[model samples]
Target: MNDLTKIMVSKGGTPADITVGDALEYRAALQEHHAQSAGHTLFYAWLRRLGSLPDDAPATLRNPSRATGQVGIEQLVDRCDLTCRPVRDLMVDYLTERRPGLDYPNAGQRPRSLS
Candidate 1:
């Protein structure tokens, strides 16, 4: 299989704190998490060699007050880049899953392509 597919399959499930921290920091955390959690034994071993996540890593860091809404945007764009899912669809799916009872305030407007 391809590298992206391998990575996707390895990720298994999304972490609860995936949406935490600054956009760039969150992405870094995700990369670290994915590398560590990969299902492939070799991939997991490789990550282990890279060392464990820092105690202060942003993934589990609690700083919601600093959230700029850019975290989700960056994740969506990255997922779309990997999976080739349309940005609008991924945005809808993310909102639906992350905040099930609430609707996105900007839902009335069409989403822009991440291309």
Candidate 2:
């Protein structure tokens, strides 16, 4: 298939308005990052780092709209697919298990207490 189609598929069918060359570069970067990632913590860290970049960051860092939470959503979707788990379920489980002190409104809801 075409490069555009390949990129779209690799990103879990998310639409990316990028040239074929850029798509290839992005694919390589994603593959490299995924390969190097130790686990979910590293993945979350990378997404947070991406989200914290200044608005005027370069194309590579700015292409994903992190300031508006788009990057986080994308990362969640990607992670869910990678782990073969439901997004809400995984997040709820993570928060409940990882941060036991937080107050979760419901068993399936996210933690509401953050200090």
Task: Provide the TM-score for each candidate, comma-separated.
Answer: 0.17, 0.19
Number of backbone-clashing residue pairs for each candidate, in the order shown = 0, 0
Model 1 clash pairs? none
Q: Which ten residues in a row have the lowest lDDT in candidate 2?
A: 36-45
**Tens-digit per-residue lDDT, 21-46, candidate 2:** 44436555656887531231232233
| Predicted structure 1: lDDT | 0.42
Residue-level lDDT of model 1, residues 1-115, one tens digit each, is 2332444444533222122222234335556887532332333223333444333333322343343334554554565555555756667677656553343436677654434
Minimum summed lDDT over a 10-residue window in model 1 is located at 14-23
lDDT of 2: 0.45
Q: Which stretches of candidate 1 lie over 4 Å from their true place?
A: 1-54, 58-70, 82-115
Alpha-carbon error at 57 in model 1, in Å? 3.3
